[model samples]
Target: MRLQDKVAIVTGAGSGMGRSIALRYAKEGAKLVVADLNLAAAQTVVDEIRDAGGEAIAIEVDVSDRVRAQSMVDAAAHAFGKLDVLVNSAGVGNIIPFLDTTEEDWDFVFDINCKGVLWCSQAAARRMIEQGRGGKIINLASQAGRRGEALVLAYCASKACVISMTQSMALALAPYQINVNAIAPGVVDTPFWDRVDAQFATLLGLERGEPKRRAVAAIPLGRIEQPEDVTGAAVFLASSDSDYMTQQTLNVDGGNWPG
Candidate 1:
């Protein structure tokens, strides 16, 4: 197993990309903390991992809450004695145009997408420092962060913040031998995308699936991304293979963002 004996915390593990990364980690022999805002969903992942003979625990956490994030780290440490990896995968997206956006919309995006990352990274880094074993922190950024998109102002700004924060975190944690990185994915075939598409289908004059079809057509790879497509990158960053790499946002969008 590539991650034998490692303990990892994967937020938003209930569904979509987060769930895939959590399952991949478990299969690689890592003891996992499958965290999600939805308790039942998280538990389902835990059950799946356990059934597959992997060790895992499910925790319901609203990552935007600093205290809750800290408690999550405490729970992980209490369960497995140490935390070797932290994947900040819990996030939400907004597709509204800038003119139609509201304060609540902006705050909501920042709170969960940006501030959530800060809370989780801080909490995990503290534990890693205490353990003196070093650690890996991976943030889920987006192509929107690299450059502006047609809509989704709040989401774009928040992801840009994540990219900046990843760089800052890598610098601060480097002295401790901890590596920090971010993944900027364009579009993936996930449940979250279905939800996002549903939200704006009316405005686009098409259904959720139509927009996704168009997105896939736009990708140079001739297909939209799958959750597993990102797991390879996640494992790389979380393992020693990427020990020398930090403070970088690797685009996993199948050449959608050429810049």
Candidate 2:
């Protein structure tokens, strides 16, 4: 149990990579606060963890809201008595063409994917500082952040923001012994693709699913990434294994892009 005795708050824990990390953290013996926008999905995750004899609580929250974000941290500290780790895995994406991108589109994407990370990490870091113990703050980035994409302009920029924030936060929080890092996942085959692919179908004039097929075929690993593929990296970052590492955004993209 790498994370035994640790208490972690995982945003977006209702599904996708967040869910995978939550379940993985529970198995490794972390008390989890499963926070998500969907109450039912979050509760279901808590139920699964409890069924496995793990400790967890589900909290429905929109991480973009600063107040709610602080409350999420408060809930974690209140429920578990201490907070040791935070995985800012909550995000949203869109595939609008460069010219089609709007102020609203950028705001919508950044509010959740970038600003949400900011709100949550600030609150968690404050608590960690008060607790006087080292902690881990892992942000969810994307391969798209490493390079610009024609069709997904806003998403690319937002993830790039996440990476930038990871660095700034890591540098700033290091004195408090909090290691801030990020996981840049590539093409993970999850419900997330449904919305992106559907938008690409109309934007790129491709048949439905063709965009995803192309994405998978481009991966040097020869397959789409799964949520489980990223948990190992998360576990390492959240555990003492990566105590000396900070201000780094590790690429867990299965060779889709080499950093």
Candidate 3:
């Protein structure tokens, strides 16, 4: 019950890490607003939380849209009365080689990964500032952002933006007692990997699971990352435990990208 009586909005809560974070927050006594582009998936999470005796609602949202992102914040405040935490997890990645990366590829990834974070954070921060109490903003970064991967140039750049924005938001909102932070996850085995695997197969001339096999083999922890592996870091950030921390990117990558 670390988040007792708190209200939280988790973007991309439909699946993977976002879904895990939403459920974890609910378990901590926080009312949740599960936002995702997939209404059905978001509702599934809502059902899970409600079945567990926790309060939650689902909304369909494209975080890349500023107006839609603001509406999401408005809906949360309307439904739950106040917002205490925001987790931006909606993102995309492509595995084209650096030379093959196109402007459209960059736009697609950045729109959701970077621009989406900005829009959602802005909307959430406005509500938190008006509440006159501190709030937590957790963004999803990636190990790729700490360095560059030739195969995912656009994605790497976008996540770097996540880290940069986290720092900027932290400094800007510190005066208002709002904390902005990020979790840099690595090699998670979510449905997202299907896309990554397919892209790698096409671009790297590898088999469907070969790219993933190589990734898993490289993990120092001896296992691929799971969505649940990221929940603890998120729970800490959303709870009072991380009140003194901000503008920091916690590596939940199982010893990968230790930086």
Over 4-95, each residue of candidate 1 has an lDDT whose tens digit, in order, gives 99999999999989999999999999999999999899999999999999999999999999999999999999999999999999999968
Alpha carbon lDDT of each predicted model: 0.93, 0.95, 0.94
Assess the local accuracy of residue 180 in candidate 1 as a C-alpha lDDT between 0 and 100: 99
Candidate ranking under lDDT, highest first, comes to: 2, 3, 1
Model 1 steric clash pairs: none
- Residue 4 error for model 1, in Å? 0.6
Clashing pairs in 2: none
Error of 2 at 110 (Å): 0.8
Taking all chains together, each candidate's TM-score versus the true structure is 0.98, 0.99, 0.99
What tens digits encode model 2's per-residue C-alpha lDDT throughout 1-259?
A: 9999899999999999999999999999999999999989999999999999999999999999999999999999999899999999989998888998899999999999988999999999999999998899999999999999998899999999999999999999999999999999999977797888888888888999999998888999898899999999999999999999999999998898878
Decoy 1 TM-score against native? 0.98
Off by over 4 Å in 1: none
Candidate that would win on lDDT: 2
How many clashes show up per model?
A: 0, 0, 0
